[model samples]
Structure formats: structure tokens, C-alpha cells
Target: MKKILTILMIVIMSTALFACTTQSNNEIKQDLVVGLEAAYAPFNWTVTSISDYSYPISNQPGSHVDGYDVQMSKELARIMDRNLTIKAIEWDGLIPALNSGEIDVIIAGMSPTSERKLQINFSDEYYRSEIVMVVKRNSVYENATRLIDFSGSKVVAQRGTLYDDLIDQIDNVVHQTPLDAYSNLVAAVTTNVSDAFVAELPVAESVVKSNPSLAIVKLEQGYGFESEESDITVSVGMRKSDTDLLNEINSALSQISVEVRNQMMTEAVLRNNESELTLFGLITKYLSLFVQGVGVTLLLAITGTFGGFIFSLVLVFGKTQKIDKKRDNIFKKIIKRISNGLSTAYIVLFRGTPMIVQAMIFYYGVKLITDISWWTPLSAGLIIVILNTSAYIAEILRGSMNAIDKGQMEAARSLGFSRIKSLLYIVYPQAIKNALPAIGNEFIVNLKDTAVLSVIGVLDLFNATRQVVGATYDTVTPFIITALIYLFLTGVTSIAVNYLENHKAGKELKDA
Candidate 1:
């Protein structure tokens, strides 16, 4: 009970931290991997493919990723004469990677909150954004100029963000549930799950632009929670230990004029209109969103894979022990049935549905069952992972069970043993011998699957990489390191599983 409550509390607190940010998978590797959520248009967003839109990137290699951060990172790479590599990670995970010595810089649009300062260091503020409200033009909130106007109005912010906290300050403002993706928060407002979304000005403008039916109301600077240019000022994230690198970046940033920075911001906002344009325009426009979404993409694969193994366990029965038939029947028919069925149910659901849909269902769907609020994302994520994994592992079990040979079960049955007793004593032990290799593979997949939890906001490794991008503004170093760490973990798990399989198989052969 204590453990469950603690887990529940952690999950609830996590929701309070969601935020609106840019993301993209639209770009994976530049010379420098600048991580950012590119979904925010004007700043970043995913569009189709394009040519003739070269600013700083030499490689648009096909069409998946490009954006404002890409353009800026490319320019920064140009200034420094370094190759650019873009790694897209989630909004929250970026920083822990930076502090842990994974990424070299965070270029994603991020606020240098005082809390973040304790983990790693930041660069000089690069750009400043404002706070605003986004709502349905027909909603009562359409005329809301200050947060105070929304007393008792339903409000929702991106979970795990500063805005989520900011939205909580309004008197009786009725803070509604948070969402998985910051980009999706607008949908909540448009759908009336929330009256309006509190966000940075760039986000509001881009959202309002992409969606004309929406209202973008800027509250009087003091009336709404407005951070100063210093507060909204975003910076490059770097390690304090690398004073030399920090010095170099600050020098580079100082050289760029405010006018150029403003123009960059403006171009980012303008690019948000790409969806209505020609194919080329669309490509040039949302390339950034594509790039930033990489974190979530990688996350999906990693979590799906790891989640498969955590829930499956090998069970064995022994025939030589002269076990009682009644007890064996209870184990197989009752306990085993329930446990196996549960594991099976999870797998069928996860494998049956798309992971993205699962992620959405996790964040939004589960809320109807509880008011604890925080369990919404965490439970949804684990359940999806658990389910996805069970499907693959169940097949592994069935195959291994078949490999044990029917003769063993019959041999045990011939000796006064009941059907359940015979199978437990005869068939199960050997099945474990056969299934070892497949189960190991599942673990490797699960290790990677840990990344998927980032979507609903578990700050696992990939998400850590994303936060790094936001904090540092530099990109190439973080992703390479992040990938290497994942590789090392998978490699280690593979070896351990192999050793166990070899040990158990050798024992099995000796007994035979």
C-alpha cells in the first residue's frame, strides 16, 4: 500500500510539470544534434519534404526533419566551423543528460529556471518569449485578458511544465487535466477539455496562426503571469565543468545581433503557415517539427521493446518429486490461469493498438477512472508497455512448451500422476531450457522500450537527451553519447541473458 501510494504521488506531481514546447523527429542527425520539440511551428514543426530551402543545413537527406533550431544550429555550427548533428528528444529529458555528461549542448527552446541551475549550467539567454492564452474564439475565455478573468474557468497546461504551475496560480481557475504533448494542449482547449491554454507568446502565435478559429489573447504584461525577458530568455545548455566550451558559445552568441535573432524568431513564426502552402513550402516550413519529434519516436521503440520483458516470467514443473495432483491442479488451473491470463490480456491490448494511440489513451483516457490525476500518464504508459510485451513473450512461452516434447508429459502421466501433475513434473522444466534465447531478446528490446515512457512523461534516457538539447543549445555530442549508453546497456543485458541460457542449457543436457 505504501509503495502504491508513493508511486501515485510521484505520478501526480509529474503532471504538474508539463509544458508547451517545440519538438521534431523531422531531423535526426545534423553535424551537431540540437535537440528541440519541433512541433511548435514558426519556432519548429514537421512538414513534408522540400529542396531550395537551405539556410545552414547541407543535408535535408530525403524529407523527415528540419526546423528553426536546425537553421539556428546550422548557423551556429557554421560560425564555429563544426559539423551539425540534430538529435530530437522530449521536452523534459534534455537536462539530466547534460548534467550526467551525455550531451554537449541543449539548443531546444527552454527556460533557464532556477531549479535547472542546480543540475547543469546554461548559456546566455538567446531569445525571449511572452506569456499568452489560447482558447476557442467562442469560449468565455476568448475575452480573458488576464488569468484572473478565468476564475472557475477550466484550464489545462502541458503536464510537467512551468506553464502547468503558472496556470495553478489563478484564483479558482479550475485547472483541468494536463496533456502528453504540449502541442496537443491546444486540442484540449479547442475541444473544451480546457477553456484555454497558458503558453509562451511564440507558441500562442504559431498555434493561433495554424488554427485561425482559435483566439490568441495576450494578457496585460502584469495582469497575467509574465516572465521577464530574462525569465523567457532561452539559452544554450552546457556543463559548467567545460568553462572553455561555455566561453566559446557565449562569445558566439554575443556576436549575433538582436535584429538577427528577432528575424530568426520571426521566420520561425512565419513558417507555421506552411500546411496550406505548396509541397515545397510545406517541406521548408515544418522540417523543424519533424526534427524535434525524434526523441518521442526513439522513445516509442525503446519502451515498447523493454516493456515486453519486464512482465514475462518462466515457470517450470517437476515430475520426479511425486507432487500431489490436487495442489498441482490449483497452481495450474487457478493461480496460473489468472496470472497467465492477466499477462496475456496485457499483451493482446498493447500489440493490438498503435503505440501512439496507446500513449494518448494513457495520458487522457485513464483519467475517467480516477481523480488522483497523476496516475493518468504513468499507468497508461506501463499498461501499454506491459501489454505490448506480453503478446511477444506469450508466443515465446508457447513455442518453448511445445519444444519440451509430448513424450515427457505422457511418461509422467503413466506413473499415477494426474494431468496437471504430469505436465508440471514432466513438460515445464524442459520448456524453460528451450525458451531462454528468445526471452533474452525480449529484455534487450525492453531496455530500449524504456524510451517510450517519455511520451507520457517518464523522464527516462531519451527524454533526458531531449532536455539536454533545450538546456545546452548545442547538439552533436549528446545524441552520440546517448546512443552509446543504450548500446552498452543492451549489450550487457544480451551477455547476461546468454550466460544464463548457456548455464541452464548445460545443466539440462547433463540431466538428460
Candidate 2:
């Protein structure tokens, strides 16, 4: 009873802290909070070091963002006389983030297509470029000049972008599944996962410049994919309610001449090509980031595993509460019934859904209710992991406890031990001894599963690899390093689990 009361107190205090941390500044915003993918080269990409061209990324410490998008955002913020704050977000999450009030504007080289105009208002055009297909240097598609020329070839693009939609324009093309980033598309083409990928002219140029083995196929003007003028022009994305801010942004954009815009893009392209590193060079250069990623991954896995174990105890107790008709009053029986129902519901709900979906719903859903400033990705990620993990661990504990003989509990009661004391002192210890291996497996599972947290911008190993890919434009090397790190972590964990199992078995034999 005391333990349950303490857990309730901690939960209440946490709720209070969460309430206290909410801030309501979106209505009267001070900073120009800009959101972008930061993985689209020349448009926006992440970098390790700060420069005159780079803007600090609010979510990623010790890293910065640079490219044409960042430069345009800088000018916009300066014109508005507001401090600039850039956030690196996944492409698919940008519109949702803007709508949920998590970000003020999006300058992520987003084309203001007719489809997007319904959800959010777009500022005047900031940049324009034609569509082009990128292919392996010596591939047959490299010489193609028309959409029909590439028929029967596999093609892809970044997921949820105009580029991906353009794939349908190619006649009889395989139309492979779109990837999540330009880096992934580049990798797909280079590694033969796909024959080609559609990209904007500047982006194609950036990829070709970074990779000598890739080439661009620019179709004849009349034979190219038909596109609307707005489809080719990138604009600032903001909430529909921000009419005044939209006009002000357009005013700031008008101040820059076409010549200056071209010049800025040229400079950005040059800066994007500044890095010339081999795989080994990139690994050495970005070693610290990999280390930081490993640290965050381990932190989430360890804490999530231990924290889930603790919470699962409470869940087990709730689900297993006795409904004594004779000794229990009507109020007590009702409480027990409710507890069992809730615990069962919680386990079923969490176990039934994927963690990726849960993370997206929880992370974005929280923003709808409170100021996003307090509900950060890491905080939300930890809570999600704990809650999801508790459901599974509860069943594990319950099954392990039940496997023990009823004779043990009856004997304890015969010795005048209370129900709680008997379970805690006699039954739980042996159940834990039986369940240790499964609990250790949960830890290992967390070490790998936490990679999904990256979708919600948790900065786990996978997210770190994506950041490195954004900076270096070499997708293969970063992922290889990340895989190795994951292997090392899981390997160590497995060895530890094996040792604990062996030790437990040996001790039992000795006691016998």
C-alpha cells in the first residue's frame, strides 16, 4: 500500500511539473521559429561547425544548419527584427509542426503545390528551379532526353515531395517506393536499389557535384514533365491565420533582386561542395557525433528498460487485484474491477500498436494541448518507451509469477505472512529469478528499437546517421558506422545477460 501511494505521488508530481512547464508565446511570438528538413543539399543541410553561412539548429546542440533556405530565413528574420531559431524536422513532419504551433514558419525548399495551399498559406516565391532526373554515370538513362525514354527503368524520389509525385510522369516506369531523404535517394541510385530519382535542378547539381559517379538527365524543354509554375517555385510555409506575417515576409522577399538570389544560390552550391572527404575521413571528422548518438541510444534503452520494470510492478498489482465478495465492501470491489479493466486495456492498446505510430501520435498530440517548448522529443520519447514497455513487461511478470506453485503462497499465509509480504518476500524473488533472462532480452530489444524514436526527432543512432549523411552526402559510410555501434551495444548486452543466467543456474545447483 505504501509503495503504491509513493508511485501515485510521483506520478502526480510529474503531472504538476509538466503543467508548470507549458509556455504560451505562440500567439505573441518573439523569435522567428523556422522549420526545415536540413537534409536537402544547397537548399538546407546540417553541418558540424558554425560559419558565417550557418544558423544554429535549436534541437541539435553543437551542430548548425546552412544552405540557401537558411540564408533566406536569416534575411526574413532580420527584416522582421526577430531572433532567428531554426529547427531540423523530417520533411513529412514540417506541415504538422507548423499547424500544431510548434514552429512559426517552414523554409525547407517546399514547393507550394495546389494540394498544400489548402492546409497552410505560402509566402511569395523565394526560389525557382526545373525538374531533372539523376542517374548512375554510365547507366542507359543517363543519355535519355525525354520522360518516355526512361520507360521500364526503376525510379524513386524523396517521400512526400513534388519530386516523388513527378515519378508518375515517366511512362511505364517501375516507380519504386520513395525514400525519406535526398541522401537516401542518392544512395538508392548509386547502389542500384533504383535506376534513377527525380530532384530539383539545384539539388541534382549538388548531388552530381558531390558524387562523380552520378549524372543528370535534363530533358528537352518541350519533352520534359509538365509542371505548374507554382510546382517549380519554393515558398515559405506558415499558418493560415498569420496573414500579417505573410505580407511582411513577401515584403522582405521583394527587397532581394533576382541577381542576388542567383548569387546566393551559387555561393550555397559552392559551400555545399566544400567538403571533400573519403569514408575514413568522414568517420574521423564526425567521431564525436557518433559517440553522442551512442550515448543517447544507451540512455534511452537503459532507462526505459529499468523504468518499465518498475512500472510493470504497479500494472501487475492492478491487474491481479483480488475481488473478494465476502471481505471486500462494494466500494473496494468496484475499485478492483476498474483497476483490472484499465490495466488490461493499457496492455492491449500499447502492445497492439507499433512504436513508430505511437511516437508520432504522442509527440504531435501533446503539442496540440500545451506549448511545445516544454514537451521536447527526448522527454516525450522516454515517456513513450516507458509506457509501451510497461505493457509487455507486465505480462512477462504476471506469467512468471503464476508459474510458481500455489503451495508457496499458501505456505506463506500458513506462517502468518500477509499477502503483500508473502508476494514481495517469497514469490516475487523466485519469479524474478525465473524472469531475469526475459527482462534482459527487453533491454536488448530497447537498444535496437529506440532507433524508431528518430522519426520524432529523438537524436538516436539512426537520426545521428541521417545528420551525418546530410553533412557529408555519403549515406553508406554513416549507416555502416551506426550499424557497427548497434552491434557492439547489443553484443555486450547479450554477454551480460548470458553471464547472469549462468550465474543464477549455478547458484541454484549449489543450493540443491
Candidate 3:
């Protein structure tokens, strides 16, 4: 056991040393890092194939991003004489990523509204598009000609955008909760969860073209949304401190004529709508992505479960240590009290909070405090799962410890074993055996709950499926594949854990 612990310690120390050494080199790389939500069509989306127009996303192997934004980014990179690097960040995370220096600019068709200007600076408009409402072809709002025509109807839009704010323009509008992605809005409208959703003219055209059941309500003159000019124009976002880089990007944009930009956008729409394959074809085309996603999911679950088990043991010992009030030194008593208080707080805090909330806080919070390039989404995810699982495992271990007979401790003491040795070798081992089933359940739970890590862009199973949905615009098939993969993983794990339980039981019977 001591030899194994020594090896583990050495590996951890080496990894930390390597990370610190490589961070500086990564920071100094002169690539132009551009962040975007690849789920948006025409503007940006993921593709399996690489071409002159498609750029590979950083750290996500075999996944290429393509769209007008990607082409524009490539042009800007060429103009600035730098290699372009694209990151498929979630919409809500793009600004945070840019601010944290994870990405140098945001080219995600983001509008530079007054509210957003306070946080980050924007370049001159790269794309100007009119706002339109997308509705079901058979819905009552399909024939509507103006904003007020859909009054008292259930409307929705993508959250944290100008479109979401525009839903209130209709008097007595039943505005629904804004979703996170355009695909989600598509689903909402298609499923009748919402009457209509606000979208830019190009996006509406692209969506309507692909989804025959959908239609766009393009209001005539004097019937559209009344908004500021900035709300209708998309721009590249950068840090307020990056005035020099922003000016260079604007200069590059100035060189591209409006006619050329429109041509690029038209080409994007055509390319985006070209994939008319059936659902099965999409699954077959992207099968490798699902396979990779499963591998990452399993890695997170296995590492988090075993790592958490080890840490839970430490927490259990800390929280359960008993200081002799009469004979122990004052120093020992104080140390024991502090350790117990800390252990209790850790378990309570982690257990009480949701894992998704914890993941966001840890991922962004760590980036906020220390801008370490080595701390990727996977690392942050592992830390979150381990911390969360340890809390539950600690409680399980505590109950298991209480179930053990008190005489076992006395027997070890009688045999001249120290309290630490008794707990480590005899008592704790028995407690772990008793808690094995609960620990196994925690592992299975981790396998499923790792889906939440997608919010922080971990590229786990759920995120992979979302990538497929973004590419194909078919939500049902990809999710079905994801569910089956999860079911297979959990089922196999259940069998393995049951085998271990039975083996332990047989070993105990033989000993008795």
C-alpha cells in the first residue's frame, strides 16, 4: 500500500510540474484564437470534413468548424499574418472566454448592443441582418405581417440576446423562457412549446429552408421591430484592453466589401442546407464522434469515482477522529477540532449544492483567479466530480464506520496497534467493504450526471450529441444514440460491481 501511494504521489507531482512548464509556451503562441457557438447555422456550425473553408476546433480532434464566421476569421487571420484557431464555446461562455484570454476574439455573430459594450469592445460590423419571427407553417402566427399581429401569443427567443428582449414588443405577449441555442428554439417552435421565436433574417431563411414545416414572418415597412442600429449588426468582440487588436480587426473588415460579405453569407447558407441526409446517415457520418464522446465520459466517471473514494477516506478520518479530552495535549485537541470542522463543512457544502452550479463556479472561478492554459474543461470537470462524489461517499463511510463493532478497536489496541494503524488497516477497510455498494451506486450516478459538464464545454457524451444536433439539425436521433450509450455503460458497470460484491461476500464466508 505504501509503495502504491508513493507511485501515485510521484505521478501527481510530475503532472503538476509539467503543467506549470508548458503554460508559458501555450500563452506565447501567436495564433489568433476566435470563439463561436458552432451550433448557429449560416453564421457558424460544426462539420466532420475539413476543407479550405473549414477550420479545426482547438483540442477537439477530428471536429472541424465551418461557416461565414469561420471564413471571415480566416481572412482576418491572413490579414494579420497569424494562424487562426477556432474554439466552439457555448453562447453564454463566449464573452467570459474572451475576457479570460482563452480566446482572443468572439466571431459568433454577436451583436454589439449598448449593454454588452460596457463589458467588452466590438469591431466594426461584419454582418448586418434584419430581425424576423419564425413560426410554424400551420400556426396562427404564420400569416402575421407585423410585430403586433402576434399579440397575446406565446413567443420565445434565444436567451441573453437582443431577440429575447424584442419578444416584449408585442402587447400582452406570452413570452416564454429563452433557450440557450437556436436548435433549442427550433425544437420549441416545432413541438408547439412556443408559437414563434425571434431570429435574424438570414438564420430564419436558413431554418425555414431546411425545416419545410417552418415559415418566416417578414414584416413589411413600418411593421418590424423598432430597435437601435447596433442591435441589428454583428461584430467581433474583444477585451476592452485589446484596443490595438480591435483596430487591426476593423481594418481587415474595412477591406472586405459589402458585396463580398453578402456572397460569403449566401455560400454559407447553401453549404449549410446541402446536408439533406436522413437521420441514419447523420449518425453513420458522425459515428466516430459518439465513440470519442463515450471514451471521455468513461474517463471522467472512472477517475472521479476512484479519486473521490480515496479522498473520502481522508475526510471520513478527519471528521471522525476522537481527541482524548483528559490525556491528549492541547495542541492535538485544537488540531482535531479544526480538522473536524473543516471536514464537516466540506461535506455539507458540496452535498447541498447542485453539481452543475458547482461545475460552472469551479471552471470559470479558477479561470478568473489564475489564467492557466493547462486547466482545460476536462480537468475542471474531474475536480468538480471528485469533490462532489467525496461528499456523498464521506457520509456513506461515516454510516459504515458506525455499523462496525466497538470491540474491534479495543481488540486492535490490545494487540499493541496504534489508533492510526487500527483505523487504517482494520476498521477503515471493514467500513469500506460495508460501503462498497453505495460507492458503486455513486459511480453509476457520476456516469450519468457528467452530462451537466457540457455546460462548461467538457466534450463529454452529451456535448458530443449536441454537436451532432448542431450539424444535422436533428435532435431526436442524436439523443437516442446518447441515451443508449449511457444505458450500455451503466449496465456494464452494474454487472462489474455486482461481481465484486459477490466475490467479497464469498471471501468473508470462507474466512469465517
Q: Supply candidate 2's per-residue lDDT for 498.
A: 94
Candidate 1 lDDT over 382-427, as tens digits, reads: 5676666667776676678767667777777678897666655666
- Which residue pairs clash in candidate 3? none
Please write out the lDDT profile of model 2 over residues 1-512, one tens digit for every residue.
99999999999999987766654434344788999877788899877777899988887666678999999999888877777999888777899889888899999999998889999999999998889999999888889999899899999988878778888888888989888888888889999999999989998888888888899999999998999898899999999999998998999999988888988899999888845577788878777778777888998999899999999988988898888789899999999999999999999999999998998899988897788456888888899999988998999999999999999998999999987898899988888888898999899899989888877677777787887887667788788888888899899999999999999899989999
Q: RMSDs, each prediction?
A: 19.0, 10.3, 9.7
lDDT (Cα, 0-100) at 164 in candidate 2: 82
Error of 1 at 493 (Å): 29
Instruction: Give the clash count for each candidate.
Output: 90, 0, 0
By the lDDT metric, which is better: model 2 or model 3?
A: 3
> 1 or 3: which has the higher TM-score?
3
Error of 3 at 51 (Å): 1.4
What's the CA error at residue 130 for candidate 2, in Å?
Answer: 1.2
Q: CA lDDT, every prediction?
A: 0.60, 0.87, 0.88
**Per-residue alpha-carbon lDDT of model 3 for 1-512, expressed as tens digits?**
99999999999999999998899666765789899888788898878777878988885767788898999999889887777888878788888777877789999999999989999999999999999999999888888998789889999998999999988889999989998777788888989999999999888877877678889999877988899999999999999999999889999999999999999999998888844557677678888888878988999999999999999989998999799989799999999999999999999999999998898788878887898878888888998999999999999999999999999998998999998999998899999999998999999999999988887777888888887777666666778888888999999999998999999999989999
